[model samples]
Target: MRRRRGFVQFAILHLLKEESMHGYQIMKELEERSNGTYSASAGTVYPALQELMEQQLIELDTSSDKKVYSINENGVKHLQNKHLEGDFWVEWKERMMWRNSEQSIQLRGAVDRWEKEFRKAMKHARGNPESVHELIAFIDDMTESLSKKSTKQGDRS
Candidate 1:
């Protein structure tokens, strides 16, 4: 679960949405918030900042020596469109715990219990194999419903 996808972009935008910060401060905040899971180097973060500026999503305050970066109107609109950040942070925390072997035992226990319950439900749910089309549709619906419920639960946490 060591996800290293568009996380750099999300982390940068997620922090800039809160308040203006310089490049070094942004890096530190990302590291602290992610518990060092995303301790990206300047080589990783600076280019994204530059790209955001190029896209006119962020503005640089050169009045001070720090060169603070503040999200502009366009950035706000972008974050609103992309939903800033939520689920990614939750998954990142879970991954960290699993990696450190801290809460993984608990997580495994919960998942195992859930699987047992789900199989029990499936036993009653499974009907004649002659209804293959209905079975497929039912499975699809269950997947969508479970995914949405899990997403809502994640957001709540």
Candidate 2:
């Protein structure tokens, strides 16, 4: 849903690296492998598979009832060149789990700091309207600074 092109591509390549599967099978595999974090709907998976077919990364197994797909030489080369062999998604999922936990901790720390800062600032401005004005000015300045930094980074990227 987030429209991560790289993530989708990586999933396809990873799936093919293991073995051949159909679109539905790939979707089920992805959901199970990612622990439900990454799910490729038919709409998304089918189109991506079509693109990969067009790119000659995979070939269809038209000799069966189900339209299965297997990695071709190009797909194998792609996987090998990418240095992503084995169940690469497993390691990625593990790292993501740890990263999420770390982020939760960091978010808690940030929220606590923000609360403390806000309380202190409010206490200092209890009777002075000028402090409120200064707070607004500070917020505006920080917003402008963040906007500029974001714009510059986007430009660089």
Candidate 3:
């Protein structure tokens, strides 16, 4: 999952606004929230936290052995002022929902099997022009068939 620039900083601020958390907790929460798509490493997360602290958007508490961070007034103000919450979160939620659907799961499995078979056939058909042409034709036909089915379904809708 490639995120847009500054997305990590925005996500960190958003998470801190909810509650105080340590570095490790922040990493895990991000992973869980993204449906295990975005895994935050210590190297990436810690630096972002440090940058936020420097900007005074968040505050670090050193009362306990482990450092915990929470969003300060400036952080809340920045979030509200920027109004950057809509697109990223909405897209994430929609993707998660779509990926979890039963139809999506079945389609993913079928695609995986098709890829494996395609690779095996390609290996055997290497250096054979006729075999390669047949493979390309098969792909083109399948694509046309699926497109027509999709178009018909859209017309019915």
Candidate 4:
């Protein structure tokens, strides 16, 4: 998904405004806030935190083994000036609401199970052209079947 430049930074600042958090906590909080749509990685979050520190928008407490980050007064002013509370959050919530549904939860579980099995099968099929071809054909057929079912459902709707 393409994102606007500095969006990660903006999100980091928004999160820090609420409370101090470690890197992992920031990643998890971003994921949770976006309803699993935006999964923040350490690579992304840590660098953004470093940039925020450089800009003096946030501060890091290294008193403990784990570095905790908190938004400073400048960060609050930045958010206020930019008006962080806006349609971005409303659109994000609307877009990701499906992920919070019971049906979506079950579908996610099934997809995860399928992915695990697919990975195992791929590992076993490595270097075997015939096995790989069969797997591709099976996946193609499954995708076509699902597409047709979806089309039929749309017609009903």
Candidate 5:
């Protein structure tokens, strides 16, 4: 996915404010928090980390062959000055969700293929009661499951 300018920097420092994290872990955090969006590659994350280090916004500790990064005093001050807290993170996540809509690349591709297959099946199954009943039952079951999930999510909110 295409990230906005300075997006990587903002994400790295934002996460560093919480705890020291290795580069891989930081990438995973971005992926998780962004809901499968903004998965920065090593090439992207390392350079950002290096730049943050050069700017003295973050400190690195090498203990177990991994460079763990933590936000320093300067980073904390920068974070505070920028005021990038809950609202900012929520906005960033929303943007990421828009960019990476449809859940995932795999899901998008699968949905496209599945749709074509279903259309073909419907065309062939015309005037077939058994096939129609089977498809309707499957769709009903899926709809019921999805309805339950939606209700649970609404409860959480």
Candidate 6:
């Protein structure tokens, strides 16, 4: 369930919101929290940290071994802005489970089950003439529902 690189940025922002952590700490936290689904590779974490630092979202804290990072006032304000943006919370929730192993396994299982179901449905719909129309309508319905949900959720935010 490794997420896209965009997720790394969001995850870092959320992590900073919780507490200041070093790059390595952030990586470990992400892996531990998401059940290993998001092992923020060093290549990804370090650069993101640098980016955040540049953006004034975080700053280096005095530490002995590793440079600890803590969210600055700007960071909190940034997070609040993201909260107002609507999808940040949902994305954060989805990313937060990286800490819980059971949740991660469950998510993987759900995805596998969905893939199986999709294949089965495709097989069933292979021949029938009405199948194409049904599939199209189903896809349209799903897109519409998702759009409405996103819009409604945005308004609520």
Go through the candidates in order and give the clash count of each: 0, 0, 0, 0, 0, 6
Q: Global CA lDDT of candidate 1, please?
A: 0.77
| TM-score for each candidate, following the candidate numbering | 0.54, 0.55, 0.54, 0.54, 0.57, 0.51
* Candidate 1: worst-modelled 10 consecutive residues by lDDT: 1-10
Question: What is the Å distance of residue 144 in model 6 from its true position?
Answer: 15
Question: Candidate 3: which stretches are off by over 4 Å?
Answer: 1-5, 85-88, 92-157
Pick by lDDT: which candidate is best?
3
Model 2 lDDT tens row, 90-112: 77676446545768779868878
Order of models, best lDDT first: 3, 4, 5, 2, 1, 6
Better of 3 and 5 by TM-score: 5
Off by over 4 Å in 6: 1-6, 84-157
The residue pairs in collision within model 2 are: none
TM-score of 5: 0.57
Candidate 4 structure quality by residue, lDDT tens digits, 1-157:
2333277788788788888999999889878878777777877888888888999999999999999999999999998888644566555565457666788899979988998999999999999999999999999999999999999999998
Q: Kindly list the per-residue Cα lDDT of model 5 for residues 51-117, writing each as its tens digit.
A: 8999999999997798889999998888778765466578778978776776666786887898888
Query: How much does each candidate deviate from the true structure in C-alpha RMSD?
Result: 9.3, 10.8, 8.1, 8.6, 12.9, 7.6
State which candidate, 2 or 5, has the greater lDDT.
5
Residues 1-157, candidate 1: write the lDDT tens digits: 2334365776687788889999999989877877875566898889889888998989999999889999999988887787534576676655654655747767777878977876766675677564556656877998999999999999998
Name the lDDT value of residue 87 in candidate 6: 59
Q: What's the true lDDT of residue 127 in model 6? A: 84
Per-residue lDDT of model 3, residues 38-69, tens digit only: 67899889989988888999999999999999
Error of 1 at 3 (Å): 12
4 or 6, greater by TM-score: 4
Clashing pairs in 1: none
